[model samples]
Target: MGRTSKIVTGGLLVCALVAISIPVGKEVVPGLFPQDQSSTVTTPAAQLPPAALSQVASVSELSPDAPLPDAAALSDQLKEALKYDGAGTVSVYVSDVLTGEELFSADGWTARTPASNQKLLTAGAALATLGPQTRFTTRAVTGSQPNQIVLQAGGDVMLGRDDSKPNEIMGHAGIATLAKKTAESLAGAPGPYTLAIDDTMFTGSTLNPYWPTEDVAAGEIAPIYPMALFGARYVAGELTGPRPHDAPVEVAEAFAVALERAGVETIGIITRSKTPEGATELGSVQSATVDEQTQYMMQWSDNYVAEVLGRMVARKLGEPVTNEGAVYAVRKSVRNLGLPMDTIWTVDNSGLSVSNRVSPAQLVQYLNILLKNPASSAGQELKGLPIAGLTGSLSDRYIEPPSWEAAGVVRAKTGTLNLVTALSGYVVNSDGRLLSFAMIGNGLTDGPAPLRTVFDNAATVLAKS
Candidate 1:
């Protein structure tokens, strides 16, 4: 029979099995079978309980042998859902992950503002260049002069002011823990020591010139620093509000306070200086692995973490660890995946800049490349994407209505701006075929919420296909 016919037949067989497993007047406890009595119906050697039947159905639903969704039907459904009346235009692209076949396309090749969706490219480059297992290090060492100590930045902006929490991504490396170690190492050796900060790891402007000044004041992002507590936020665990413009200096002050608490006397004034060559190491702490940080970045759409990852990617490639270097590294890495670079324009690693331009087709194509090899570095980046209605920025989304059907089944990255909304990721359709898609709405005069819903609805269509 034809592929679609085979799928229909198999689906009918599964329904029959389920219908026969439960007899009349028997209460089925969801996944469990009726335990009161055995049915008189005789057929197969053994019948599966509801739970086992569910497992079988799930396995079959994801089976590689399952049929693909009909392209024409999927196209019509998506076209209807993508229609918007408010203001802006919407672009969408969907493709079969296994065969690289384009299933749906609507203005997919047109470049538009990507917003935070740019984080996906940054995440991919970081994993490909730095490896997921790599961890950034923050070090405390003896300075050139007597009674001098240097706090060296190592690209870990997620440091905690308190003791390290082994379980967390934000505070995996704690300043207090490092201070204790440093105090112990310097026991009986000094009185008051001058603390210096070496934040030269990242070169060039700390803040992106392309970002709006008001956005920075509103805590959309802060100056990029090599080392920071709570990703440069003024307070730990607080994701929004005003941020310190001099994050490195704030970190140094915190370190000085931590040193005093650990029984080491500090001179109070923190200086900016490079660590002396061959300086004696006092103590150090390592941040969470790049994989963990990337997951956190994707889940929360963290602009700070995204930029840091990009700079580190530049460092790995021996490129200048500046904003320009980070951008170049990200674009180069994505291009190396064999994607066309002519259509993609990125001024900053974090998609906070309206100048950033990326097409829906490009995102879907990139996702397909990652899906092809699950074990590759670029492939591992997919694991960090936010799950619909379940995690990160999407926790409150996909919780209602037709879009709710995609909850827990869709894994994607969300992007937002005053007039732009975007979603890009992958989902396994009801037919068991893996599909990658990207939806971007720009110039939305009706506002972002409505356009966001449109994107969500489009994803739901793919899930139920």
Candidate 2:
């Protein structure tokens, strides 16, 4: 009887230990593990900030037959795979903009750094504030000294020799043409020539500390004082480069040299400065509409163009040109439209700043603002987007078999960076169902394929569901 008592006592102790583990299991892996490891693997519920436990609870509760009543049982399987797909946290949301019905929402409120996906938001903002028909300009003025000339800047991102992709060209005709014509105009006037470049149009604000300074100086972000006479980057083959800026400077200097080759002699120092107004518009050029600029900005994830345009918007709205001022302008303009921007944080005009954060729902909500406004001149440029596989950055996303969800039917923006990937856009299903979806993957490495697949799969499911 003593030995029996000892065995029973031992069993009771083991049971008590197991009881402590049950909560751990329920808290960590949810349904599968029977024993709890809260002490070892889970932070106590009280210690976790609201988001940690909330994401788990929201992702783990998919019961297959509820939200997606159409899928019945397969729903839970989908949720399970997404719960821990290597992305520390993944959020997905689907909304019928036409009916304003949110069909599925999983951790949609959590804001994450969206990488290039932030481009979409910038594009949206550009369209909402800057008119769709907007164009940037670059002009030339003759300096006080004969044969000397100044090329004015307008912070045009598309300024390049190549206007092949429409608004992709930031500013002007050709520096060569402008310079050459000036040479011809002064053929008999000045024995020696000198050309001065004035970039006074844009205030020399800090060129984003987040961007590589060397590359930016070389024009990686976008050349400040750009001069593209013939087509730029697109057709700009061969030639050596200091950077993007160096390339344009070389081009401008080459034009001066070419004028010498044509019998004109330049003795004046070629320098950079701003050209005053009332300055002659010697051979001016206009950029494409804002729609075209947005398309290209997304295609290559061009942060420079987006941010430059952002500053331009700030200037237009009477905001200061500094980073802080630019974002202040963005916030004011967005709020002016009646959209709630309390959760949106803009550290820089571009999403290059790590401090930038926004939610999937907010993106959709922003898009909805454009959709509902038909009256906004700036909001109508959504046409510049690549229609899935048709063109631009999304040219190869969302593989569909000759249906509405196919390449040409669904149009959207893709975002990504280290451990963070996001896609937000409007899609139409084969059955004429219109859907606006936002998928954000955080805790993944910086790249697009994995993020692409998640969105593609989600779109496929969204289309069918």
Candidate 3:
């Protein structure tokens, strides 16, 4: 997955309003069943409340006692909320972070498509295996031909072309700076040179086969490459468009363009090859720290950063640096952390693939493990989740009625596919006790917007419990 920016729309509120007055139409429903399944059965649509409400949902109004509401009580409220959606199967799991006592569970152990929630696993694995301070290096070395330079790929996917302006996500390693240094090394020597790209750091397919082919054009993913600039490609300051087939070539071209702009003559076509033996080091740039990169991945659901981190973990484990290798390494790392392995399977780190399966228990338990040791590198992953109504994907969410109480109080990683919606994170209950939860909605026929309210309202219920 290449780093691609997404457009958040206001359609969610519109759908919520429509759902409140009239039942969701069959035509508007997304198929809930997995694509591999045979049929798509339409389920009765759930009714949502009107978007306009007199009173704003507020957490300041509700408070609970020391012994929090028991499991039976919590289950009743959550079930009632989920039943209102009437779109798909709902999985819920919640527990006390301090006592480790289960507060509620509804099909929590069943495997379901996780969407972006899978990034939680990837983030944990990267931090646990590679540590927080790990940095990727991109270097320019002497090429085989005189005046020819080789750009070595060292897993810096967010490499930028401009140094004056920092990238929106990856703020380090500017290609302009590298070009300046490279030009300094060749100060008295050459007139024009050809640039060669060395992208062998990653050893497999540039694109994951399991991903939907159409997602590329849809701007949901880009070619996975070890070396890319500005998230592979950005147009008119917007991160959109299909990934170029030869991403490394495009990177090399950008490097060449940078070199030329820096008063260096770049002649001949850009080629892909390894740096020659004993080649002198010209210049280098290091990527943003792994932790920073992970935070960006979670913040924007940037698939590219997530995939890159997965490969970094794979490299740390001495496994292949391919997509399959990343998946295997991430799962292994999760298991090594003593988290549940069964009922959890993933083919890609970004959760762009529908084949990815995870259980609510796995997600909730993973977070709890990290929350218990917040001082450790792996534990830092919890800080990456989007805060309700504040940052990242949740910037515009949690502002609606009913679920509004969770605003500024709940922090969670969200997941959404056509017919799936998932929320997993920690919330401070009315008792002031921190709790962890994982909720997933699959087979959702009416789409995620209406169901999103259900999930948000459920979390609000927990916050007030």
- Give Cα distance to truth, residue 212, candidate 1, Å: 1.3
Name the top TM-score candidate: 1
lDDT of 1 by residue, 230-337 (tens): 999978778789888888888888888899999999985888889999999999999999988987898899999999999999999989999999999888988887
Clashes of each: 0, 28, 1
Q: Alpha carbon lDDT of residue 112, candidate 3?
A: 90
Pick the winner on lDDT between candidates 1 and 2: 1
TM-score of each: 0.87, 0.72, 0.84
- Runs in model 3 with CA error above 4 Å? 1-66, 164-168, 235-240
Write candidate 3's Cα lDDT for 1-465 as tens digits: 111111112323343233222321211111111111231132111111223332222222223344566678888888876675375888889988766778888898889999999999999999889988788889999988888899999988887777723444553788888889999998998578888888888888878999888776687788888888766665323445666666678768777888887888988878888878999999998888787788778877888889988998999899999999999999999998879787788999999888998899888888878766665678766657776665687766776666665555577898887788999998766555667899988888888888888888899888667
What's the true lDDT of residue 445 in model 1?
A: 82
Which 10-residue window in model 2 sums to the lowest lDDT? 27-36
lDDT of 2 by residue, 49-90 (tens): 233333332112323222322433334534643444443677
Candidate 3: residue pairs that collide: 32-443
TM-score (C-alpha) between model 3 and the true structure: 0.84
